[model samples]
Target: MQKSILWVFIALLAVSCNQTTKKEGLTTEADKTEKIVTATINELLASPADYQDKEVAISGMVSHVCRHGGQKCFLVAEDGETQIRIVPGGEIDEFKVEMEGSTIAFKGIFRVLNAEQTEEHVEDHESKEHHDVEQSHSTAEKAEYFVEAIEFKDITP
Candidate 1:
């Protein structure tokens, strides 16, 4: 009976040690260890190729979130000429519409759209009106690079 009690105590202690404590903000040990390169949304878009396939960090105000489920988010800077799509992964589950206008810092790897994705993006744009069609064509020309986020934390004031 004493041995059973001792074993239960050991098991409880092991579980507690493995558990992760949630802090007010989402800052993991991995985030701290990564080479987080802080840049604005515009900077990233301006030199997408330079940051391609490399881990980068960017901070921007969220302009939109996927209405259906918040699986994706659009980040924009002051210039607003370009935007970066944030594909939430790892610790990030979804982005809420309420998060709009809130500043967020994201750490992730940048990737460029493949030929198939570019074709599909253009096709989607072609479905809209003539003006939107032209804009979509331009978006297609831009290569549609995006970031695959591993971590994101709100920095709204």
Candidate 2:
């Protein structure tokens, strides 16, 4: 009877340990699946290479939105001078003019145009008649770095 009881106790202990290990494994898997990267606009701009093509979350104040067809928008960093361009993607159709001056949080892929692409973009911008005058966001408008936003939310206070 004593030997039998000892065997039962050992089996129960093994089962409990196995269950704990499984739970821990599940937690680890959950962590791995929830890998959302939230970053500041400045940080993303500082190292565009690090974030290229990667999905990231960033927030900033909307400094400008293209009035032509609302195809694009610019977000100013905390420094107020620095800005980055954001183009709609995913299910988004356009950025409304009302969004300007509102703080918005955006989730998207950080994209960097290659040298050839950048040259083409600059040429295209210069060709536009409306671009003759340099605006505050002119630099960012022609920057190689921009975000292709998939989702965004206004967080203005």
Candidate 3:
């Protein structure tokens, strides 16, 4: 009877070991592939080699959502070197609701550059300056989520 129990335990251990090996192999294969979606700031930064000097896509909450110049606003979060900038325009009310200390989600191409290429100029690693919503915005177009081909969606929970 003891021998049978020992055999069962050994079988279980072997099965678990095999599963672990399979999981490790899958993770190894994933390291060679490209990732597009980032759930958090840490995960995004973990793979900087893929977006050191390129554009990538990501989504996250608007940690620092503030409007500048009265009309334009930017969401600031740690996106692999403050490269995460998005100004949501569509669904204004919904977006506002999110900006009110709520969670928001944005889906846009990230320009993971050391410098940001603005509409007419390039700003490099600025310390996240926010504008006044009522004073900075004039046209509905300013509500856009991106400046030079960047955009986002509201993420509410």
Candidate 4:
């Protein structure tokens, strides 16, 4: 009877240790996948290539949200003049018009268009009748760099 009780205790200890190790492994994996770099809009625009295809966290004041189906939005940098475009991705269907004029923080991947893609984007922008007059965000709207946002939060006060 005594030996049986000792063996049972040993088995329980081993099982508990194994469960703890598994939980630790899961936490480690989550840490690796959640790694993200934070940056400002101006910094991102200045060296877009450095952050290309990398997950980044950025915050800015939402300057505009496309009136057409909210397919896209623009964020003004701390400089107050420079802007960068953000498109929904990773389960996000679209941006909301109410986001305009609010400060928002976004996490996503930075993408840059190739030469041909940039030219096409520019042409498309120029074709828009509403763009007949220049605007502060016009440069960013027609530029090759933009962010594909996976998550966002309104931090406006």
- The per-prediction tally of clashing pairs is 0, 0, 18, 0
**Per-residue lDDT over 33-75 for candidate 3, one digit per residue giving the tens place of the 0 to 100 score:** 7455544434444564544433345554544434342233344
Over 1-157, each residue of candidate 4 has an lDDT whose tens digit, in order, gives 9999999999999999999999778867755878678999989888888999999999999999988788889999998988999999975899999999999999998999999999998888777764557877778888899999988999998
TM-score of 3: 0.36
TM-scores for all candidates?
Answer: 0.66, 0.77, 0.36, 0.77
Candidate 2, residue 87: the lDDT equals 96
Per-residue alpha-carbon lDDT of model 2 for 96-119, expressed as tens digits? 999999999998889999999999
* Model 3 backbone overlap count: 18
lDDT (Cα, tens digit) per residue for candidate 1, span 1-157: 9999999999998877666454423466565677766777677778878787888888878877766577767777667656677877776788789988889888888877878987796676456432433431244233578788887789998
Give every collision pair in model 1: none
lDDT of 4: 0.89
Error of 4 at 101 (Å): 0.5
Return the clash pairs for model 2, or none.
Answer: none
Cα RMSD (angstroms) for every candidate in the order listed: 6.5, 13.9, 15.8, 10.6
lDDT scores in order:
0.72, 0.90, 0.43, 0.89
